[model samples]
Target chain A: MIETTQLTKRYGNLTAVDGISFKVEPGQVLGFLGPNGAGKSTTMKMIAGFLAPTSGGAKVCGYDVESQPIEAKRSLGYLPEGAPSYGEMTPRAFLEFIADVRGIAGDARKRRLDDVIGRLQLEGVLAQPIDTLSKGFKRRVGLAQAILHDPPVLILDEPTDGLDPNQKHEVRALINAMSHDKIIVISTHILEEVHAVCTRAVIIAGGKLLADATPAELETRSRYHGAVSLTATNTGEARAALARVADIESIEIDPQDHRITAFPKKGRAIFVAVSDALKAQNVTVSELALEAGRLDEVFRTITQPQIKGGRA
Target chain B: MNPIATVFRRELKGYFATPVAYVFIVIFLILAGSLTFYFGGFYERGQADLSAFFIYHPWLYLFLVPAIAMRLWAEERKSGTIELLLTLPITMFQAVLAKFLAAWAFVGIALALTFPIWITVNYLGDPDNGVIFTGYVGSFLMAGAFLAIGSCLSAATRNQVVAFILTVVACFLLLLAGFPLVLGFFQTILPQGVVDAISGLSLYAHFDAISKGVLDLRDIVYFVLTIGAWLYATAIVIDLKKAD
Candidate 1:
């Protein structure tokens, strides 16, 4: 288990991370969501025992981070922002150093090293210096170092930030593969990543926790939730026909694509009613979708007010 | 494996991982060789001793040791690897000590590579091998002291150039504290006890005593104390400035 109680970090007059508290159990991947400079990295640093909190504290596997740093850190694996490593060393040598520092020795050491190397596909670059490797290879090496010992708690800052689409998919798949028994915390600004890998997300803005919920739960707060959007042959006729449906509270047309969206009233399923109305008017619909929710819209709604308030 | 030993192994190998180690070792050997033979007048001294060689180490280390120490912490901070290092299951003191020891050992290797000088002296005439051995010990201790001071100053900044310049300036001041020119100036203004105290803290004074074939307990303690104090300051400085 990973637990932080009222953790805070301050830099002179600026409070970088406010009093934030949360907990993570095993088999759960927690996504730390925030805007740029929203203290996502700072909070991860505190939890990893890289930065001492100005107030409050954290515990990993019941060991206090401040008082029992060694014990807490022993159980934790952290990939710092930018995936920093000794650039002069090869992926093989770098992983060896990390493995040694993490106390993975003897037969188990080689096994763990090979496991991460194979998993991250770093075998080809094992001999080349990290400084000469491409950005994607460097990130994979960083991930390899973090998972070399297979620590129970893994904290990664911007794990997939610089990866290409395929690399991003592979890293997400890796996170999902490792989320079975580990308390993995990854911080990213990408909203779709939360849907892809996170079992729970803690959104912070201006160094304050704004919301903590599952991706599905947070998306439900979007105005687009339960809304039905369709591209039809006669958009105006379909809009008139949809007005007869009692469930839909409002209707809107896309200015660019001319698609019609029918928003349902509270606790109403508008997909069936809207389809029935479109068919009744003999309107030929080309494409239709019942949106689960618009996470970007919900993210903006949840975080934009504070941005305007100038809290960060 | 022990944490310090593990970090020490990596740090030491880290030097060989780049051209820095080969460059530093080659430069150190060249400078030490020429300074001993040409500047110190090894042949002209006509004595069966390495006094000429040992006399120039304090001056030689002033620039070269800082080159080694400057990158100790500064590079870690510049490349953002300090976060990865500090997050490992190692104490701050262990990290500081391991890095220092690795750098010190690297310098030791460079110093030992000057074995031809030892053979040259012995081949020239019958010299007291015991004195030469003590001089080697003293030179290694002084290098350790210099490296410790450099380690602390390196931790104070992320820029290696800044760290190098600050370490050079600090070590120069400490070395000059024992000089007659500096002591004479302080003698006219400060009290006798204060002047004596200043000279006592001088690395040159303690190193001079050891190099002159007198391995006094006080001189050894001075170097040990200097290494201990500076390494302690290094840990504290790293803690205070790491987040920046």
Candidate 2:
């Protein structure tokens, strides 16, 4: 388990992490969400024992991060921001160094090294210097090192920031495969990734926790949730007809495309009602679909600073 | 294995994994030989001794040893590997000690490779082997002193050039502490007791005493304490800069 108590970090007068606290149980993939400079990396650094907390502390497997860093670090595997490694060493040599540090020796070290290399597909470039590799390969090498020891707590920071789509898919699959019964925390500003692999997400803004909920729960807070949109031949008639539907909360019409969107009140399902109204009123509906929910909208509203006069 | 040994092995291997190690070794051997032959005139003196060679080590190491130590922490910081290193289950002391030992050992190798000089002196005449052995000890310890100073300054910056330059300047000042030029300046302004204390802190003075075959406990303590103090400062600098 990964637990934190009022974890705080400050740089001079500016607070980087402001009294943040949370507990992640086994079998959870917590996605840390934030905009640029929201202190996601700083918080990860504190829990990973790379930085001391100005006030408060974190623990990994009941070991205090500050007072018992070795114990805390021994139980955890951290992929620090930017996936830093010894650029001069080959991947094989680098993994050996990490394995040695973790006390994996002899036959076991060989097996573990081979397992991560195989899993990360590092065989082709095993002998290439890390600095000479591309961004995708470098990221995989970093991932290989983190999983080499098989520590129970895996903390990955922006694991797929600079990868192609295929590489991203592969990494996500890797995370999904290893997430069983492990407390995994991944930080990213990529919204789609949250739904892809994250079981839970915690949003931070201005060095403060803004929201914490499951991916589905957070999606429900989206304005597009349970909303129905239709492109009709007679836009005015369809827009007017949609108002007759039961529990219709709001309606927005696009003039150019003749698309009508209707939202339900109090989280009701509006699809059936909107469809029924379009059919019963003899409206010529060209297209109809329900959005999977606009998490991007919800993310923006919570992360962006609110204008005082409500203009933006 | 212990954490220090683990770090030591990796750091030593790190040196050879690049061309820098070969380059440093070549430069060190060439300079040490040339300085003794050309500047000290070892063959012209014909005294059947290596003091001509040993006398210039303090000056030679002031430039060479820091080149080895400059990249010790600076590269790690520049490449962000310091995070990976510090987050490992090793204490700061183990990491510092291991890295220092690796650099010291590398210098020791370069020093030992100058064995032809010892063999040459032995073959030419009956020189006091005991004095020669003490001189080698003094040279190794003095190299450690320079390395520790370099290691401490390297931790303060990520730029290797800056680390190298700062280490050279710092070592030069320490080497000059007991010289007439520096002592004259201090003597003219300061008291006698203060001057003596300052001279006692000069790396040249301790190394000179040991090189002369005195092997005083005070001189050994001086080098040991200086290395220990600098390494202690290295640990503190690393700890305080974790937030960076």
User: Which stretches in model 2 have alpha-carbon errors above 4 Å?
Assistant: A233-237, A254-259, A284-287, A306-312
lDDT of 1 by residue, A173-236 (tens): 9999999999999999999999999999999887899999999999899889999999998888
- Error of model 1, residue B5, in angstroms: 1.0
Query: Model 1 off-target regions past 4 Å?
Result: A308-312
Docking class of 1: high
DockQ, structure candidate 2: 0.77
Clashing pairs in 2: none
Query: Once model 2 is optimally superposed onto the true structure by TM-score, how far is the C-alpha of residue A17 displaced, in angstroms?
Result: 0.2
Q: What is the DockQ of each candidate?
A: 0.83, 0.77
> Which is the leading candidate under TM-score?
1
- Per-model root-mean-square deviation over C-alphas: 1.5, 2.8
Interface RMSD of 2: 1.0
